[model samples]
Target chain A: MKPFTQHSGIAAALLVDNIDTDQIIPSREMKRVSKLGLGEGLFAGWRYVYDGAERAGENAEFVLNDPVFRNATILLGGANFGCGSSREHAVWALADFGIRAVIASSFGRIFRNNCARNGLLAVELAAEHVDRIAAQGAEPVDIDLEACRLTLGDGTTIDFDVPPADRDMLIRGLDYIDFALRYADDIDAFVTRDRRSRPWAHLRASES
Target chain B: MARTLFDKIWDRHVVRQLDDQSLLVYVDRVFLHERTGSVALTALEEEGRRVRNPQHVFATMDHILDTFPGRGDRTLVPGGEAFVKTMRRTANDVGIRLFDIHDGRHGITHLISAEQGITVPGLVVACPDSHTCTLGALGAIGWGIGTSDCEHVLATETLRAVKPGQLRVTFDGALGPGVTAKDMIVHLIARYTAAGARGFAMEYAGPAVEALDMDARFTLCNMAVEFSAFTGLIAPDATTLEYVRGRPYAPQGPDFEQAERNWSELRSDDDAEFDLEYRIDCSDIQPTVTWGTSPEHAVGIDGRVPDPETAGDHDAGRAMQLALDYMGLEPGQPLKTLPIDGAFIGSCTNARLSDLRAAAGILRGRRVARGVRAICTPGSQVVKQTAEAEGIDEVFLAAGFEWREPGCSLCFNAGGEGFAPEERVISSTNRNFRGRQGPRVRTHLASPAMVAAAAVSGAIADSREFAETGTNGQDAA
Candidate 1:
């Protein structure tokens, strides 16, 4: 996962609310054995012709295909982005597409966490603020994780909030597994106590 | 202390709280499907981190398998066999329980988890599939995680998660006939938009929920993900205990009694506090169906399609307009009158034995309407066998519906069988996203009975009306 600190790039505005993981990367595209090379499969349902193949010709109506935003590294989206399914491929596709940041009013919990875990900055701002940023399509916007702010070229700055720990992990390029393992003692203590408290809850293979 | 049901279960599982306020919690059960599970297993294998507890981990080959009768270890999706074989080999090498193709226990992950007693109450269950929350009906805390998180859990029987705020949705009053848990959940999603329950662990309670059977409770919790909720739960009760008493994986005798004793105390205290509360009168809901791409675009069977232009502030107007446009539906059109090309009564959402019975009741004496291709895929081999024993399969087959084996069929047009582009389908599946069933395929999310009614009418017809008249639904149309 790449570390996030400060990034400035072209922003593409996709103002569709409830952009489910299914719509982002349909299940059909997730059949690949490896997670590599799913960037072309991103939004394949809406991104390409209905030929069941990738890059079959872009769907002209889709904003992602708009030549103006072809090099977009930031995505400005509507509320409740990534609402359905917990497919990490949704984030994989976004990252694979060269999108380093996504700004939305809100996001699905799993999708948001997946973004942070994978080093994609998922920024949540007020709906009004997001609308303002989304209106500036394909324009350069600067996102500073340490500053906790996004700056438009016209000197307009909007503050956003990310969990301090999430921001630290992103800034330090840390893995959750390592972070979690640091608290192994606590997990062990809890499990030890819980076994006595709820002995029947244990799944004994012998019972089956 | 008066702790909510979620707090009780969550506190029990907390391994420790990190500096970030997120808890590293022990997970009792982890179920995986081929679509995403294979990735996690392969990652774990590559990392050389063996599963911490193989008995606690269960893998099943769903999602990509063909639901066709006599199907072997083959799949319709190109290169899909690799996933099945990988899951098989990984489960074998790791000593995790695997429900392979042709295994009588093979089924959708969530369904089999409950049916096989893998998801007992007072435990935390995790899975890569979003609808893993379905097991919450058993009074378990079920969290849906991505493949990366799945890998983490496979290596260590715990996951680091931010504790969610609590929300309680209580359903009061009596449910009208033919109004199922599916209707109630769809109504809830429609009332509160898709993100209504965002960041909340929701508990379904009150008289209506308490009165529901175990299977119906699963239906309600299954759609909790549609609301963008972290998870959904219902405290275990006598009904739940009765349902799990003799399942193949459930405890027996003295151990079962001890489990019951623990589960009995798993409910939210009367004085428990919630961050939010919503109360719905069960009688207010009707046989519901989603008319647009998102689940929140639901309207009652008797209601007309909404005029997006009349939507209030916020993105309501634009969202509604987009949904209507993609659905190819006109404002003010009746939802029940629209013709359908396909009717699918299968998926993790509503493919249980009881769901099949509900659909069979409507399809008993009537054939699927002319030109309508209807398919009934049971949720598992166990469900299929049980339905067959009860003549439910004969009812469906005799009604001109294709009877298929269990997996996930026609739920989404991934690679195998599905409706053609522009074809309208009323499905019992959870999602109705644009092009989900096929390219340009218009899907209406509905209950099993509703899907059955549509199949018999070749159009969107109210299931309650068919239930009342016991008609084939063509006459109603």
Candidate 2:
């Protein structure tokens, strides 16, 4: 995982609210045995037209199909991005497609957590700020994680909020599991205490 | 200090606090399905980490299982059978319970969890599927997690999590006839768009919610994922106790009595404060259905499809227009007049015995409309057997509906058994997204009874009127 510092890239605007993970990558494209090569499945349903069991051509109207935004590294999404399904494949698709940062008004809980684990920068901004960014018409935008601010091409700066822990992990490029392991002793102590307090809740070894 | 139901459960499960931010909360149970569970289980094995508590975990082959009669390990989705086989092998190697295709307990993860009493009140349940919140209807702290998080929970039996801010949605007036819990949730989502409950732990309270049966409560909480809430719950009461009593895995004898005592105190206190609150008169909520892609794009059954010009914001208006184009619908058109090419009646969202019974009642002496293809997939093998014993399957089959095996059949078009591209469908499933059932297929989300009505009429007909007046002379709403 690379520590996210700053990036400037053309933004691809997706103005539809409640863009769920299923729409990001439909279930039909999730039949793979491995997590690799899922970029082809990113927005599979919306990305192409099916001509009787074969790919006919790309849907030219989709934002991703726009040649100008083809290499977009930043995504300007509507409210409630990554709203459904816990498939980390959604993030895998975005990262595989070179989208390092996704700015939205809000995000689904598990999707945001998955983004953190997968080293994807999920930036939550106010809806109006997002609207302004999307209206820039493919202008390059800059994001500075250390500063926690997004700079529009119009010389306007808007501060964003990131939880302190999430911010620290991003800057340091730490895996959440490794970070969580630092508190293993705390987890052990709590479990031992809970086993005593709620004896009935914990199944005995023989129960299995 | 009095606490909310979720607060009580959260406090009980806290193993230790990580800091002022999050707690290492003990996960009481974890359920897995073939779709994503194989990844986590295989990862745990490859990483050489044995499941910390094998007894607390369970796996099932539901998502990719073929619902066709006499089907075995084969599936239509490419590599789906491999997923099933891998899950079976991994679950066996780990010594955790595996509900294979032949297992009588085999069913959708959420439904089987509740049916077997694995999702009892005051417990914390985790699964790798988003609709895991469906179990919250039993007063459990159930929510979804990704594969990586699922692996962590398998290795540690706990998750790092912050306490979600609480939001309470209360419904007062009585729900009119033919208006099921499905209608209530669809209405709620339309009122508060998909992100209305974002980041909050939601509690559905008030007289109407309390009056719902256990199965109906499951229907209500199943769509919490659509609301983007961390989870949605209803405090356990005597109704819940009765539903769980005598189940295969529920506590018995003195243990049951002890559990009951604890669950009785699982209600929010009168003075409990919420970060947000909403109130709805249930009577105002009619038999509702979505006319577009998002669940929030819904209206009453008698209402017309919305016009984009009235969508308030420009972006919203554009989105609405796009949805109308995708759905092939026109503004101001009555939903009842919109014909469907097929009908589906199964999913984790609404495939229980009650849902089956409702659909059967509508199809008892009726026939599916000509040129309309309809299928009924039971939620589980147990539900399938029970419905058969009660002659519900016969009723559906006689009415020209295909009575298939239990699994997530056509809810998602992952399996090959789905409507053709551009075919419009009225489904009892939760999501109605574009290509959700098939490429370019339009889906109208509705309850099982309403789906049956649509199948019989070949259009989006309201079940309320169909029930009051028989289907004999019914035109549209």
Candidate 3:
């Protein structure tokens, strides 16, 4: 994971509400077992014209395909963005496509967690603020994770909130598993007490 | 202290606090499917990490596996076999149990988890599939996670997660005829919007929920993700205990009795307060179906397509117009009588034996209308064998519907088999996202009986009209 202290880049606006993970990267495009090479498949359903599964050409109507916004590194979206599926590929696809951050009113719980783990900044801002930023078109926006603020192209700034733990993880490029391992003794104590109190809940090796 | 059920579970699972909002929570069980499991396991191996508790982890080959008769590793999605092969090899190398294609227990991750008694009350279950919330029907804390989280759980048997607030959604009164759990959940999402329960762990309560059997409860909780909830749960009752008693991995004899007593105490206290509360009258809910891409675009079966002009707010109206354009539907067009090209009854949402039996009840003496392609894929090998023994397969076959092997067939086009482009399909699956079934395909989410009714009529018809005089034939159990 790349540490994310700050980033400044062009932002594209896709203001449709409930922009689910399927639209971000359709299941059919996830044919590869690996995560690499998904950048081309990001938003495949809308970014490209399809003739029975073959990408016949780019759908120039899509915001991402617009020449002015083709290099956008930040995404401005509507409420409940990435609202379906637990596919980490959606976040990976966005990161691979050069998107460093996403600003939305709300997000799917798992998708937000995926973004945190992958160092893709998921900022929750008011819908009005997000809409205001989207109105800036392809202009560059700056995000300061350390300061918890987003600066629009017009020099106006809006405060955003990322959960404290997720913000710490992103700024430090830390793996949560490694962080969790630090409390090994606490985990072991809980397991020992839980096993005695609720033996049936713990599956034995023989059961497997 | 009158703690809610969610609070009790969260407190019990907390190994330590990671931050002001996050806790290091112990995971009791982890379930995986080939689609994302292979990637997570391979990544873990590359990191030189081993599963801390392989016995508590279970994997299956479902997401990308072919459901054709005599199917093997071959799949419709290009390069899909690699996923299955990698999952099988990785599960073996990691020493975790793998329900391969030939395994008699092979099925969708959520279904088999419950069927095998791998998800018990008060346990924390994690999976890589969004519908993992289905396990919450048994009073468990089950939520979907990304591959990185999957790897974290596999390596440490614990997860760092922010504790969610609690929401209690109570369904009062009884569900009317032709109204199933699928309708109830879809109705909730449609009325409250997809993100109604966002950032919350939801609990289903009240008389209507208590009346539902285990299968129906599973159906109700299966769509928690669609509502953007961390998970949805019901208090474990006699129905849940009875369902778990005889399952293969369930506790035995004295242990079973003890477990039952503990599970019986898993409900929220009488005075427990939730962060949010919603009370819905079940009688007001009709057999529902999605008319557009998102599940939130659902309406009663007898309702008409909503006009974008009345959709409220410019953004919502624009979204509705786009959905209408994609669906090729008119604003005031009635949902009923709209012709359909295909009908499907399967997926984790409604493919258990009970779901198949409900569809078979509707198809017993009826034939799928001409030009309508209908199919039924049982949820598991055990469900398939049981349905066959009960003659449910004959009903589907005689009705001109294809009886297929058990797997997630045509549920998201990952298996490479789906309805043609622009083909309208009435399905019992959970999602109706754009191109979810196939390129340019249109999908309407409904219950099993509703799908069967559409198959027989070759159109979107009110299932109540076809119900037998005294019964709706929609109850799973």
Model 1 global lDDT (CA atoms, 0 to 1): 0.85
Top TM-score model: 3
What are the models' TM-scores? Answer: 0.97, 0.96, 0.98
**Structure candidate 3, residue pairs in collision:** none
Candidate 2 C-alpha lDDT tens digits along B333-412: 88986888999999988888888888887898999999999999999888899989989899999999999888888998
Interface-residue RMSD per candidate? 1.9, 1.9, 1.0
Q: What order do candidates take by lDDT, descending?
A: 3, 1, 2
| Model 1 ranges with Cα > 4 A deviation | A51-55, B468-477
Deviation (Å) of B379 in candidate 2: 0.6
User: Best-fitting candidate, measured by lDDT?
Assistant: 3
DockQ per candidate, 2 decimals = 0.64, 0.59, 0.82
TM-score of chain B of 1: 0.97
| Shift of residue A84 alpha carbon in model 1, Å | 0.7
Better of 1 and 3 by DockQ: 3
lDDT of each: 0.85, 0.85, 0.89
What's the TM for chain B in candidate 3? 0.98
User: For model 1, what is the error of residue B310's alpha carbon versus the real structure, in angstroms, after optimal superposition?
Assistant: 1.2
- Candidate 1, residues B107-179, lDDT tens digits: the string is 9899999999888888899999889889999999889998889988887789877789999999998688788
